[model samples]
Target chain A: MIENRPFLKFIEHLVLILGVLVVAFPLWMTFVAATHDAARMGQVPLPVLPGPHFFRNLDVVLNEGLWGGDGSGVGYMLVNSMIMALLIAFGKIVISLTSAFAIVYFRFPFRMGFFWLIFITLMLPVEVRILPTYEVVAKLGMLDNYWGLTVPLIASATATFMFRQVFLTIPDELLEAARIDGAGPFRFFKDILVPMSRTNIAALFVILFIYGWNQYLWPLLVTTDQSMYTIVMQIGRMLEGAEEAPQWHLIMMTALLSVIPPVLVVLFMQKLFVQGLTETEK
Target chain B: MASVTLDNIQKTYPNGFKAIHGVDVEVKDGEFLVLVGPSGCGKSTLLRMVAGLETVTDGSLKIGEREVNNVEPSKRDIAMVFQNYALYPHMSVYANMAYGLKIMGLGKAEIDERVKNAASILELTEEQLERKPRELSGGQRQRVAMGRAIVRKPSVFLFDEPLSNLDAKLRVQMRVEIKRLQESLGITSIYVTHDQVEAMTLGHRLMVLNGGNVEQLGTPLELYEKPASLFVAQFIGSPAMNIVDTKMHENGNEVTIAQNVSLALGGGRLKDRAGQALKLGVRPEHLVISEEGANTLPLIVTLVEHLGADTLIHGHFGDDKTDLTVRCSGTQSVKVGEKLPITASLDHIHLFDPATEKRIEF
Candidate 1:
C-alpha cells in the first residue's frame, strides 16, 4: 500500500475475483438448471442460461412430490424444517445459558466433572452414535415426531462454551451489587445475565438454525413416515430409482427452496449476526 | 441512621488463610469511620465483612441491634459503592438508581420520586438521567454510583476505595463532594482506603490496620500527635517520621545525638530506661535550624525541595551518615553541601522501646 504498486494491486484484485467465481459457480449452475424443464436438463452440456420453466418447476415441487414419490409436497417439508430449526436453536440457547450460569456462579460438588461431561459431548456427533441414539428414540416411541427430529441434536457444546466465556467476563461486582439490591439468583439471571448476553444469544441462533436446517443423516434415521420428512431429507430421497435420467430441474428447485429461509434470516439480521459472531462486548 | 458494631469479627478463607484477624470497630449513628491501610492489609476485607459480602468466620457483627453475621447482603440494609463504580451498563442512570428500590417492591411513584431527588442531589440533569453509564465521564459515573447508593436509603453505607480509580485532581474534588454528601445524609458509614490523606480528611475516626491487625484507632489529630507504635508513627505522616537508633545516657538525664553529641533529656523523660538503646522519632516540622551550640547537630545539606510554602532540607546527621530531614519556611535560602546546625526540642521528641517498638510516654 505504501509503494502504490499498480501491478501488485492488480494481482490482488485478480485473485479475489477468482476466489469469488470458484465459490459462486456452483450456485450459478444450480440456478440455471432450476430455470430449465426436465427435457432441457437431460440434454448434454445443459443450457447455461436461464430457461422459462423455473416457476413451473418450483410450482410442481412445492405442490406435488417429484420422482413419482408418495409423499407430501415440499411446502409441507418446509414447514417441518422450520419447526425443527426453531426448536433446536431456541432449545440450545436456553439449555446452554442455564448450565453455563450454574457452572460459573455456583460452587457445588462435582461441578467441574459435570462440565467436562457436557464438554465431551462435542466429540460425539450424531453420525458417530447413530444406531444407539435411534434405538433410544424408537424405545421412547418418539419416531416420526418433532422431539425425535430436534431434541437429540440440541445439547450443544459450543453454545455452552460461548455463554460461559461471556458470563466469566462480567465483573464480579455486578453480582455483588445485585445481591445487595435484594435480587436472588433467579432474579439476577433473568434481569442481568440474560439481558447482557442478548447479542450472543442472537448470534448463536443464526448459527444453530443453519446447522439444524442442513442436517441430513439424523432426520433420515428418525422419520420413516413420509409426512414427517424435512426438505433436506426429501431432496435426498428424490435421487432413488435414478437409473434413468434423474429430475435435475426439480432437484435444483428443491435445493433452492430449502436454502432460501436461512439465507433470508442471515441477510436480515446480518448486523446482529456479525456483531454476535465477532464481538463479546457492547 | 443506625450504629454498626463489629465485635471481634474474623475472616478465614477456604484455604485456611486468615485475611482479617479479629477486628473490633464501633461506628456510632452518623459517624464516618475509615479503615486505612496498605494493600493486602485487610482494610477492604473488614469492610466487606460488615457489608455481609464476606462471611464472618469467628464472631458476630451487629447493625443497629440485630446480629447480621449470617444475614444475606440484601437483608443487611447496607449500600456499597464499589471501587470500579459498578453501574449496570445496560441501564440508564435513573434505572441504575431505582433498581434497588424496585427490587424492594417500592411503588412506581415512590421509586420515581426517590430517583429524581437523588439525581438532583447529585446534580445530574434530566437529560443526563436517560443516558447509560458508558455515556458519562468518569466523574459523572462516580456520582451515578453514589446516586444508586443514596436512593436505597439503607441504614449503613460501605465504600470500598471508591476514589482510587479517579485522577489526582478529580480525586481531590470528589473527596470534598463525598464529605459534603455524607454530612448531609448523616448515615453510619464505613469507608476503606489505602490513602492516609483521604482517611485523615474524611473520617471522624480512623482505624489503621497493618497485616490484618489493628495498629491504632483514634482521631486524625490524636494519631498524628500520639502514635501507639513505630508503624503508626511512620505511616500517618507525609514524608514519614524520621526514626533513628539512639542510646540513653547514664543517670537517665540525657540521650546521645549522632553517637557522640549528648542532648540532655529534660523533665526526667524516659527516666526508667537508663543506659539502654532506644529508637527516637521526630517529625520534620519539629526540627529547627539552630546556631552552632551545644546539643545541636551540624548537618551538610544533601537535597532541598522547595514547595512554595515550605522547604524541606535533607541531609545526614552531623557527618555520622544517619539521614535526617528539616522543614523551614520557603523563603529561607539553603544550598546543597552547606553545613547547617539543626536541633529538636526535648519536649517534641518521641522515644520508643527497641524490643517492643511501642512508644515510651513521658
Candidate 2:
C-alpha cells in the first residue's frame, strides 16, 4: 500500500491464484466424481463438469450406505462419527483444562514429575502405542463401543500442554483477587479461568473436532462391528478389490459427506479459531 | 468494619529464604494502613500474608478477633484489588462485579441490587457496566475493579498497587477517589505501594519497611519529621535528605565537619556521645545561603536546577568531595563555582549514630 508498485502486486495476485488452484483442484474433482453415475465415472477421460446424478448419488449413499458392504446406512455412520467427534473434543478439553489448572496453580509433591510424564507422552503418539491400546480396550470389553473409540484418544498431551501454556500467561493477581473475593478453587476455575480462556477453548474445539472426525487408524482398529464404523473407515471398506471394480461415485460421495461436519465446524467458529490460534497471551 | 492484627508474622519460603521477618502491627477497625517500601522489602509479602495468599510461616494473623493463620482467604472475609486491576476480561462489568456474590450463592435480586449500587457509587454509567473490561478505559476499568470489591462488602479491603498501572494524571485522580471512597466506606484497609507519595496521601498511618523488617510505623507527618532510623529518613523524602559524616568534638558542645567546619550542639543533647562518629542530616529546604553563622559551610555550586518557583543547587562543601544539595528560592541568582556560605537552623538539623544507623536523640 505504501509503494503502489503495480508489477509486485500483479505477481502477488498470480501466486495467490496458483495457490488457490492447487488446493481447489482436488476438491473440484471429488465433486465432479460424486456428481456422475457409476458407469460415467468408469469411462475414459472422466467428466470435468459435474453430471446430473448428484442428488441420486447423495440419496443412495445416505440411505443404502456403502455398496457391497454391511447394511448399516451412511446416515447412521454419520451419527456415529458425530458422537465420537463430540465426545473426544469435549472429553479432551475437560481433562486437559483440569489437569492444566492443577499443574499451574497448585503445588503438590509430584507436580513437576507428573507434568514431565504427560510431556513425555507427546513423544509416544497413538500410532506407536496403537496395538497395546487396542488390546487394553478389548480386554476391558470396550471394543465396538463409543468409549473404546474415543477415550483412548481423549487424553491428549498436546491439548494439555497448550492449556498449561495458556494458564501460565494468566496474571497471578487474578487468582489472588478471586481468593479474596471468597471464591474457593473450583469456583475460580469455573467463573474466571474458564471464561478467560473462552477463545482458546473454542479454537481447540474446532481443531479437535476435525481431528476426531477424520480419525481412521484408531477407529479402524477397535470398530470391528460394522454398526459402529465411522464414515471415514467405512469408505475404506467400500474400496476393497471387487469383481465390478470399485464404486468410485459412491465412495467419493461418502468422502464428501465425512468432510462436511468438520468444514461446518471450522466455518462457523472461524473467528474464534483464528483468535485462539494466533493470540497465545492476552 | 473489622480490625486486623499481625503478631510476629514471619514468612520464610519453602526454600528457606525469609521474605518477612517477624512483623507486628495492629490495624484498628476502619483504619487505612499503607505498607510502603522499596522492591523486595517484604511490604508486598506482608500484605499477601494478611490477605492469606501466602501462608504465615511462623506467626498469628487475626481478623475480627478470629485467628486466621490457617484459614482460607475466602473465609477470612477480605477483598483485594491487584496492581494489574485483575478484572475478569471476558465478563461484562456487571458480571465481573457480581461474580463473587454469585459464587456465594446470593439470590438474583440481591446480586443485581448490590452490583447496581456499587456501579452507581463508582460513577460508572449503565453502558459502561454492560461492556467488558477490555472495552473500558484504564480509569473506568480500575473503577470496575474497585466496584467488584465493593459489592462483596467484605470486612477488609486489600489493594496491591492498584493505581501503579495508570498514567500520572489518572493515578493522581484515582488516588483521591480511593482515599475518598475508603473514608466514606470506613472499611479496615491495607494497601501496598512502593510510591512514597501515594503512601503518604492515602494512608491514615504509614508503615515504612526495609529488608523484611519494620523500619517505622506512624502517621505520614510523624514519619516525615521524625523518621526512626537512617533508612526511613532517606526513603521518605524527595531528592533524599543530605547525610554527611561529622566528627564529634572533644568539648562535647561542638561537632567538626570535614575537619574545619564545626557546629555547636546547643547543650546536653549529646552528653554521653561526645567523641563518637555521627551523621549530620539536613533537608534541602532547611539549608539556606547565609553570610555568617557558626554552623555555616562554604559551598561551591556545581549544578543548578531551576523550577521557576524554587532552585535546587547541587554542590560540595569547601575542600571536601562529599556532595550536598540546597533548595532555595528561584529569585536568588547564583552561578556554578560560586562559593556561598550555607547554614541550617539548629532545630532543623538531625543527628544519627553512624554505627547503629539509629537517629540520635535531639
Candidate 3:
C-alpha cells in the first residue's frame, strides 16, 4: 500500500508538521493551565499567554496540594511515588535484560517453551489479569507495600522480547572473539556485550521508565494508604473525588508535572534510542 | 607454540544432519595449514572445531599437549580473525588492538606498547589508531582485526575467510601481507578459505575437504600438480581444470573422445566396477596452441577472455564434449569459430574414472 508515492516527500512533511502541532496542543494547554487559575483555564478558548498566576499557582500546588499547607510538611507521598516508579523501572530493566540475554544466547532444555511463554505474555495485556494479580498480592501481605506496587509489573515481557530481538543480531564472531580473548560470561558481558548493546539498553530504559511512570491499575489496587500511592494513582483519586465539578487547572498542572519526567527521558534518549535500534539491526 | 590434532572429528546438527564425518588433520607447531574447499564443503566447520567453536560430536581435539575438545576457547590460547573483520566497531583501532591484552589484565603501559608495535608493523599511522572501524576503509579494518589477533600472542591463530570481504586488489595485497606476517611470527595458524589462490599462497600445507572428508592434504604445489582425486584437480585452479569424458580401451592406455582422439595413460585397466569410464584433466596453461603432437585435442573456440597476461579460450572438445575451457598466454590471437589443436604433455594430464568421478589408481 505504501509502494507508490510514499508519504515521505513534500506532502508528508506538511502533514507531519500539522501532526506535531496537533500532539503538542494538549501538552501546551497543560502548561498554559499551570500558569493560570481555574477561572481563566476553563474558559471557552483556553489561555495561551503568560500570566501572573504562574508562581501563585506553583505556591498553591506546593502548599495545600502537595506539601499539605505547612511549609515543613512535604507529604512524603510524592517521594513514595517517585521511589516506586524509579525502582520499578530499574527492576524491570534488570530482570528483562538478564532474562532476554538468557533466552536469546543460551541453549538449554525447555528454551523454546519458555520463550513462547514469554512471547504469549506480550499479547496478554496487564489489564486482563489485574484482579487475579491483586488477589495474589493481597494474600502475600504486600498490600500498601512497595512490593505490591512494583513486583507484579516488574517483569516486562515486551522489553524482554525487544532485547532478545536485539541480541539475536549481534555477530556470533563478537562473542567468539570475547571467548578467545579470555573473557568468561560475566567479563564478556561487562567488557563487550553491554557496550555493544548501549542503544538497545537505552531504548529499553525509556520503554520501562514510561511503563512504570504510567502504571495506574496495579498501584491503585495495592496501595490503600495515600502515603504509598504513586503519581498516577494520586491522579486517579484526584479525578475520582471531583465528582460533578473538577479542578481542571490543578489536575492539568499535576498531569503536566507527571508527564515531564517521561517526556524529558524520551527527548534526551531519542538519539540513543535511534542509534541503538539501528546498530542492533546492523 | 602449539600443535593442534583433530582425531576423527565429526559434526552433526540438531536435525540429524551430519555436516562433517570422521575427519582427521594434524597441524604441527608453527605450521600454517589452510582448509580449502567450495561452499558447503564443511571446511569452515572443521576449522571452527579446531578453534573450539564447534563441538566435536565423537572425536578428540588437542592443542599443544592438552585435549581442548571440552575446554573453552579462551583457555585454549587461540585467537580468531573473522571473515567480516569483526573488529569491535565501537572500539578505536588502538582499543581493538589492545582489548585482549587489557582484558587479560595487562598493565596500561604494556598494552600500549604491544598495540604500538602491531600498529607500526601494520603501517597504521598514529591518527589512524584513534579512528573506529566505521571510519576506516575495508583494508584498514582488516588490518586492525589482524592487529587484535597479533597482540594476544596466543599459542595458535585461526583465520576464517578473512580476505573474502575485501575487494580483489585488497584481497591480493592482504593475502601476501598475511603470509608474510605468518612467516615472520612463525605462529601455528589454521586458515580457512574457499579461494584456492589464497589457500595456495598462504598455506604451508593445504587440506582440501569435500563432503566433510579430506580429499587431499599436502603442500600447495602438491595439491596443484598432483591433485589426489578429480575433485582436487578441478577445485584447486582458476577456470577449473578442464574435465572431459574419455574411455578406457584395451591395454593400459585409455581412449579420450575417440580412438583418433585418444589419451595415453599409465594406470592399468579397471573393471567396469572400477568405474573405468575415462576422463581427461588438463590445466589451461599446459595445453599447446597447435595439434601436431599426441595428447593434442582440436577445438573450435567459442569465446576468448583476453586478460592481458593470459587469454582463456572457451571451446568444445567434441560433438559430444559440451564444454571445454583452454588457457594460453595473451600472445595468441585465436578468433572464435577458429579450430585450434592444443597439445598437453602426458605427464601433466590427470585421468579420472568417470563412474566414481575419482582419480584412477596408478
Candidate 4:
C-alpha cells in the first residue's frame, strides 16, 4: 500500500477486481435466477442475463405461497420474521446491558465467580444444547409462539462481554462526579452510562438484528404452525419438496426479499456502528 | 457557610491496609484549608472521607452540627471538583452545571438562573455553555467543573488537585482564579494537592501530611517561618531546605559542621545537648556569599543554574563533602570547582535532633 509503482498498482487492481467478482458472482446469479420463469430456470444452462419475468415472479412470491412449501404467503412470513428479529435484538441488548452493568459496578460475594459463569457459557452454544433447550421450552408451553421463536436465542454472552468492555473504558471519575451531583444508581445508569454508550448499543443492535433474522434451526424446531413460520425457516421448508421439482423462481425471490431488512438496518446505522466499534471517545 | 470537623478519622481497607490513621482537624466556617503532601500521603483519602465517598472506619465526621459518619455523598451537601475535571462529556456546559440542581428537583427556571449566574462568575460565554466539555480548553473545562460546584451552592467545596491537569502556566492562572472565587463565595473548603506552591498560595492554612500522619498544621507563613519538624522544614520551601549533619560544640555555644568550621549558636539554644549529633537546617535562600571568617562555611561550587530572577549554586561544603545549595538573587559569575564562603544569620539556622527529626528549641 505504501509503494506506488505502476506494476504494483496494476497487480493490486487485478486482485481487487478478482476479489469483488468472487464475492458478488453468487449474488448476481441469484438475481438472474429470480428474474426468469420456472421453466427457464429448470433448463440445463441457466440464463446469464435477465428474462423479463422479474415483476411477475415478485408478485407470485408476495401474493401466493410457494407451491411446494407451506400455503402461507411470503408476506406473512416476512411479518413474522420482522417481529422475531426485533424482539430478539432488543431483548438481548437490554439483558446484556443490565447484566454487564451489575457485573462491572457493584461488589458482592462471588462477583467474579458469577462473571466467569456467564463467560463460560460461550463454550456452550445453542447447537450444542438444543435438545435440552427445546425440552425446557416445550415444557413451559412456549411452542409455536413468538416467545419460542425468540427467547431461546436471546441470551448472548458475546454481547454481554462486549458491553462489559465498553463500560470498563468509561472513567471512574464520571461516576464519582455523578454521585456528588446527587444522582442515584438508577439515574446515573439512565442519564450518564446509557447516553455515553449510545453508539455501542446501536452497533450491537444492527449485528444482533441480522443474527436474529438469519435464525433457521431454532425456529424450524419450535414452530409447527405454518402461520408462525419465519422467512428463513420458510426458505428451508421450501427446499424440501419431497417428490416434486423445487420451484426455483419463487424460492430465489423469497431469498432476495429476506436480505433487504438487515441490509437497510446496516445502511441506516453504518456510521454509528463503525464509531461504536472503533472509538473510545470518552 | 458551614464548618467541617474530623475527629480521630481513620480508614482501613478490607485487606487491612491503613491509608489514613487518626487525623483530626476542624476547618472553620468559610475558611479555605489545604491538605498537602507527597504522593501516597493519604491527603486524597482524607478528603474523600469528608466528602462521604470513603467510609470512616473509626471516629466521627461532622458538617455544621450534624454527625455525618454514615451519610451518603449527596446528603453530605458537598460539591467536589475532580483532578481530571470529570465533566460529563455528553452534557453541554450548561447542563453539566445544572445537573446537581435538577437532581435536587429545582424548577427549570431556577436551574437556568443558577447556571447563568455561575457561568458569569466563571467568565464562560453563553455559546461556550452550550458546547460540550471536549470542545473547550483544559482551563475552560476546569472552569465548567467549578461552575458545576457553584451552581449547587453546597456548604463546602472539595477540590482534589483540580488544577493538576493543566499546563504549568494555566495551573498558575487557575490557582489565582480559584483563590479569588473562594474568597468571593466565602464557602468552607478543603483543597487537596501535592504541589507545595499551590498549597502555600491558595490556602488560608495548610495541613502538611507525611506517611498518613499530620506533620504540621498552620498558616503558610507560620509553616514557612517555624516548621514544627524536619519533614515540614524540608517540605514547605522551594529548592528544599539544605540539611547537613553536625555535632554540638563542647563550649555549649556553637555547632561544629566540619573540622574548624563551627557556627556560633546564639542564645545558647543547644546548651543542654552539647557534644551530641545534630542536624542543621538552612533554606537555600538564607545562605549568603561571605568572606572566609570564623562564622562562615566553605563551599566548592559544582554546578550553577541561572533562573533569571535568582541564581542557584550547587556545591559540596566542609571536610566531609556534604552536598549544599546556596540560592542568590540575580545571575552570579561563580564558576565550577571554585571555593565560595557561605554563612547564615543565627536566627535563620535551625537545629534538629538527628534521631527524632524534631526541631530543637532553647
Candidate 5:
C-alpha cells in the first residue's frame, strides 16, 4: 500500500478478489440451490444460476416446514432460535458484567479464589462436561424447554475475563472522584463504569449473540418437542431422513434463513463491535 | 467555612510500611495550607487521609467539630481535585459539575443553577459545557475540574498537585486564578505540591515535610527568612542555600571560614561556643562583591550563568576550596577562572550547629 507499484497493486487486487470468491462461492451456491425446486437441484449437473421458483420455495419453507424433520413450520423454529439466542446473549452479558465488577472492585475473603473458580470453567467447556451438565439440567426439570437450551450455556468465563480487563483499564481516580461525589458502589457502577464501557458491551453482545444463535449440540440434547426445536438443530434433523432423500432446496432455504439474524446483528453493530474490540474509548 | 484539625494523625499500611508518622496540624477557617515535599515524602498520603480516601490508622481527624476519621468522603463535606484532574470522560462538562449535586438529591433547578453559576465563575463557555472531557484542551478540562469542586460548595477543598500536569506558563496563570478564587470563596483548602514556588505563592502557611515528618510549619516569609532547620533552609529556596563548614574563632569575636580568611563576629554572637565547629549558611544573593578585607574571601569563578536580571557565579573559595555560588547584578561581567573577593554582611550570615543541623540565634 505504501509503495504504490502498478504490478504490486495488480497482485494485491488479484489476491483480495480470490479471497472474496473463496469465501462467497459456497454462499452463492446455497442461494442458487434455494431458488430451484428439488427436482432441478438433484439434476446431474447442479444449476449455477438462481431459478424463478424462489418465492414458491420460500412460501413452502415458511408455512409447510421441512419435509423430513418435525412438521413444525420454519417460522416457528426461527422464533424459537431468536428467543434462545437473545436470552443467552443477554444472560451471559449480565452475569459476566456483575461478576467481573465484583471481582475487580470489591475486596472480600477468598476473592481471587472465586475468580479462579470461575476461570477454571473455561477449561471445562460444554463439550468436556456435557454428561454432568445434562444430568443436572434433567434433574432440575428443565428439559425440552428454553431454560435448558439457554441457561446452561450462559455462564461465560471468557466474557467475564474480558469485562474484568476493561474495568481494570479505567483509572482508580475515577472511583475516588465518584466516592467524593457521594456516589455509592452501585451508583458508581451504573453512572460511570457501565457507560464508559458502552462499546465493549456492544462488541460482546454481537459475539455472544452469534455464539447463542449457532448453538446446536446442547439444544439437540435438551429439546424433544417439535415446537421447542431451534433452527440450528432443525437443520441437522433435516439432513437425516430415513425414508426420503434429503430436500436440498428446502434445507438450503432454511440454512439461508438461519444465517440472516446473526448476520444482521453483525451488520448493524459492526462499528461498535470493531471499536469495542480494538480500543478502550476512555 | 470550617477549620480542619489533624491530631496525631498516622497511616500504617497493611504491609507494615508506615507511610505517615504521627503528625499534627491545625488549619484555621478560610486558611490555605500547602503540604510541600519531594516524592515519597507522604505529602499526598496526608492529603488523601484528609480527603477520607485513605484510612486514619492512629489518630483523630476533624473537620470543624466533627471527627471525620470514620466518616465517608462525601459525608465529610470535603472535595478533592486530583493530580490528573480525574474528570469523568463520558460525561459532558455540565454533567460532570452537576454530578455531586444530583447525588446529594438536589432538585433539578437547583443543580442547574449551581452548575451554571460555577461555570460562569470558571469562565467555561456554554458550548464547552456540552462537550466531553476528552474533547476539550488541558486547561479547559482543568477549569471544568475546578468547576466540579466549586459546585459542591463544600466546607474544605483539597487540591493534590492539580496544576502539575500543566505547562510552566499555564501553571503560573492558574496559580494566580486559584488564589483569587479561594479568596473570593473564603473556603479552607489544603494543597499538596513539591514545587517550592507554588507552595510559596499559594499557601497562607506552608508545611514542609520530609521522610514522613513535619519539618516546619510557618508563613512563606517565615520559612524563607528564618528556616528552623538545615533541611528546610535548602528546600524552601531556589538554587538552594550554600552551606559550608567553618570553625568559631578562639577569641569569640571572629570565625575562621577558610585556611586563612576570617570574618569578624562583631556582636560576639558565638561567644558561648567559642572555637566550636559549626556550619555557615548564606543565601547566594546576600554575598556581595568587595575588595580584599578581613571579612572578604577570594573566590575562583568556575562558571558564570547570565540569567537576564541577575548573574549566578559558581566558584570555589580560599585554600580549602569550599564550593560557593554568588548572585550579582546582570550588568557585572565576570569570566571563568577569575578570582573575585566576596563578603556577606554580618546580619545576613546564618549559623547552624553541625551536629544538630538546627539554626542558631545570633
Candidate 6:
C-alpha cells in the first residue's frame, strides 16, 4: 500500500497539471501566438519559444486598421471597450449601493417582498430576455451608442444581491452611532456604509468588469457599425474577415489581450474578494 | 444637562408582544438613572425609544421640556454609547470622534479642539487618535466610543449596556470611569444594563424591569431596603431573596412558615387580609446566622462560598421544599451539612402575597 501510494500521488499531480493546462490552453496559446508571425504560426506542434514580434504585432493592433482599414482601428474598439466596462462597473456599483442600503437597512414598504422580486431577476437568464431587451433599446433609438451598450445590464441583480448581503452584515450599532453623530441617511451611506464596504465594492468591481468585458453576444447583436464596437466584437470581426483560413496569430492575440487586463484585476483583488465573503464574522 | 420624562410610555412589538407596558418615569436634571433588568426585558428598547431610534409605539417622551417623540436622534440632542462600542472601524479615532462635529458644520479648528479634549479626557494618546479602531484593544474601543459621545456635548447621554461587552475586570473599571465621567459632566444620563450591581452603584435612581414592565422604580437604597414587589425583592440582591411560605392572620402578626417558624410582624398593614397565603422575603445578607432574634428559622447547610468580605451559605428551611441563602459577614468557617439558626430583622423583612406576588402596603 505504501509503495503504490507515491505512484498514485504522481498520477494525481499529473492530472492536476493536465487540468490546469486544459483550462488555460487558449490563453497560453494567445500569448505564444502574439510573439510569432504568420509563418511561424502554421508550424506543426506549434512554436513554444518566444519570438521578437511581441511589440511588433502589438503595434499592428495599435496602428493598422481591422477589416482592411475599413473604419477607425482596433484602438478605437479598445477605447470603446474601456469606456463601456468602466461605466457599467461604476454605474452598476452606485445603483447597487443605494438600492441595497435602502433594501437592507431602511423600513420601507414591502421591502422583503421587493427584494424577492429582485432575486427572481437573477434567475432570469439574459438570453431569455434578449429579444424584448433588443426591441426596447431599438424603440428608444439607443442602438450603436454607449448607453445602448452599458444601460441594459446596468440594472443588475448580481451586484444588488452581493451588496445586500454586505450591507446586512454591517452591525446596526454602527448606523446608530452615525445617527448619534448627527448624520442623515445620505451622509450615513456615504461616510459609513461606503467606506466600511470597500472590500466588497472592490470584489464586485472585478466581477462586473469581467462580466462587461467578455460580453460578445449582446454587443454583436446590438451594434452593426464597427465604429462603436467593443473589444470582443472587434476580435470577432477580425476572425470573421480572415477569408477561409483565419489569421490564428492575430485572432489568438486579440483574444488573449481581451482576457489579460481583467485577469490582472481579478488577481490583484482576489484577496479582497475572499475577504468580502468571509467578513460575515465581523 | 436635561431632565427626561416618560408619561404613559408603552411599546408593543408588532408581533403583539408588549415589551414596555405603560411606564411612567422621571429623571431629574443632571441625575443618572439606570433601567435594569434581566435579558428580554425592555431596557434597551426603552433607551432606543428615548434616543429616537425605535418608534415609541405609544407614549410621550419629553427631554428638557421638548416633546422629542417626533424629533430625529440628532435634533434630539442626545448621544449614545452602544454596548459594542460601535466606533467607525474605517476611520481613525480622531475621525470617529470628529465626524459628528464636522457634520454640525463646526469649524475645523473647533472640531479638532473638541476631539482632542475628549481624547485627553479618555486618556487616548495623540498617536492613538490617528490610528484606526481595529488597532485598538476592546477597552480602547470603549474609550473611543465615550470620546465620540463626549465630543458632541449633548444634553443627555444614553448608554445601552456600554460596559457589558468588556471583560469582567475591564467592565468594573469602565463602569467606574463612566460614573465619574457622568459626575464631572453632570449630564442627565440614562443607562441600561442587566447588571444589578452596575445599576446599584451608578444610578442616582434605579428602575427594575421584568417582562416588558417596570417592576419597581426607586433610589438604589430604596429598592434595596424596600422593593415594591416580590420580583424586585428577588432581583435586587446578589443571591436571590428567600421567600418562605406563610399564612396571613387577622389584624396582627399571625404569619408562620413550616416547622412552627412563626413571627408577629410588628406592623404589617395587610393585617386586614388574614387567613390568606402570604410571602415573607428577606435578602441573603439580612438572613444572618443569628444567636437570637424574633423571627428565626433553622436551616440545613448545602454549600459555602467565601467571598473575602463575606461567606455565602446555601441552606434550606426545616420542612420547606425551597432552598435558603444566608450571607454572613466576612469569611467564616462554615461547612456543608451543618445546621445554623438564621433570622431576619423585622425592619428588613419584606412581605408580599403569594398569589399576586405583590408586596403588601406598608
Report the number of the highest-TM-score candidate.
4
Instruction: Report the lDDT tens digits of candidate 6 across residue range A1-282.
Output: 356688799998999999999997766767888888878887788977678788877777767754455545477777888888988899999998888988988887899998889888887756779999999999999899999998988888888988888887889998888887889999999999898899889888888888888788888888988788888887777776756566677677677777777888889999998887677655
> What lDDT tens digits, residue by residue, belong to model 5 across residues A1-282?
699799999999999999999999999999999999988987879988999878988898898876654455789889999999999999999999999999999999999999999999999889899999999999999999999999989999999999999999999999999999999999999999999989999999999999999999999999998789899998898888547788989989999999999999999999999999999557
lDDT per residue for candidate 6 within B187-293, as digits (tens), equals 99999999999999999999999988889899999999889899999888798888887777665566777656777765665667777788888888887787754
Q: Rank the candidates by TM-score, best first.
A: 4, 5, 2, 1, 6, 3
Each model's lDDT: 0.90, 0.90, 0.81, 0.92, 0.92, 0.85
Positional deviation of residue B255's Cα in model 5 after best superposition, in angstroms? 3.5
After TM-score superposition, the amount by which residue B167's alpha carbon in candidate 3 deviates from its true location, in angstroms, is: 0.4
Candidate 6, after superposition: displacement of residue B231 in Å?
0.9
**Local accuracy of candidate 1 as per-residue lDDT tens digits, B105-151:** 99999999999999999999999999999999999999999999999
| Cα TM-score of candidate 6 | 0.93
Q: Per-residue lDDT for B1-362 in model 3, tens only?
A: 99988888899988998889888878999999999998999989888887888888989889988998898877788889999987776788898888889778999999999999999989999999999888999999999999999988888999999999999999999999999999899999999999999998889999999987889999999998888898999899898998777666656455556437776556554444232467778887887787466556778789989888888998886667557788887656889998887777778888776667777654
Tell me how far the alpha carbon of residue B110 in candidate 5 is from the true structure, in angstroms, after superposition: 0.9
Chain A TM-scores, one per candidate?
A: 0.94, 0.96, 0.85, 0.96, 0.97, 0.87
Q: What TM-score quantifies how close candidate 3 is to the native fold?
A: 0.91
Query: How many Å off is the CA of A111 in candidate 6?
Result: 2.5
Model 1 misplaced stretches (Cα beyond 4 Å) = A1-12, A280-282, B318-320, B331-333
TM-scores for every predicted model: 0.95, 0.96, 0.91, 0.98, 0.96, 0.93
Off by over 4 Å in 3: A1-21, A38-50, A66-77, A240-245, A277-281, B253-256, B264-276, B291-296
Candidates in order: C-alpha RMSD to true structure: 2.0, 1.9, 3.7, 1.3, 1.8, 3.1
DockQ of each: 0.70, 0.74, 0.60, 0.90, 0.87, 0.77
Model 6, residue pairs in steric clash: B19-B212
The best candidate by DockQ is 4
Two-chain DockQ for model 4: 0.90
User: Which ranges of candidate 5 are over 4 A from the true structure?
Assistant: A68-70, B251-253, B269-275, B318-321
TM-score for chain A, prediction 1: 0.94
Model 5 DockQ, alpha carbons vs. true complex: 0.87
Location of the lowest summed lDDT over 10 successive residues in candidate 5 chain B = B261-270
